[model samples]
Target: MSLDSWAVPSNTGSMELTDTTPVHLIHVDPDVNMARFYGIELQPTLFGEVSVLRTWGRIGTNGQAMMVTYDDEAQAADALHELERQKRRRGYVPAGT
Candidate 1:
């Protein structure tokens, strides 16, 4: 099996996304043996449901993911923000910064 099977499909235009931009975070500390990545994205599916997609695991690998679907975009967006905040508090930083 491949990682794609475990992840949501790429934005192929069939399902609309409120925010196409995903938040990417990373934590790297050689001394602590910590090198991981976490990402959060909000997407709307064709079934009229909003989903918050979260992926986290060691850097340089596909990692793991957990997705939660909500009835409205507001709820999904809120979940995404909350997850980002929690990860940030745990030492995850914006990938480019």
Candidate 2:
């Protein structure tokens, strides 16, 4: 898939300076969350293939989002559909009204 399509509003919010260190805030996309539930890690391969990466724990959290790299647009679309299915099964609702 083209990077343009995947590009969306940064889930991570604006950064802020803290008393001692700088803090970076982030937001999690529901679709990405669902992918994690299915044990899929979207990463780019050396050959420029965007596929699922194998991992032990969840790849993303509440604020941070995970990205899935695909070899082509078709694969990306399929992966997205799978994520949606998982989300539906888990009864997950998107953030905001």
lDDT of each: 0.87, 0.43
What's the lDDT of the predicted structure labeled candidate 1?
0.87
* Residue 28 Cα positional deviation in candidate 2, in Å, after optimal superposition: 15
Model 2 poorest ten-residue lDDT run: 16-25
Predicted structure with the largest lDDT when compared to the true one: 1
Give one digit per residue, the lDDT tens place, for model 1 in 5-51. 87976656546766668999999999989999999998777787888
Error of 2 at 8 (Å): 26
**Candidate 2 lDDT, 35-88, residue by residue in tens:** 332233344445645554322224354333456676654585467556645655
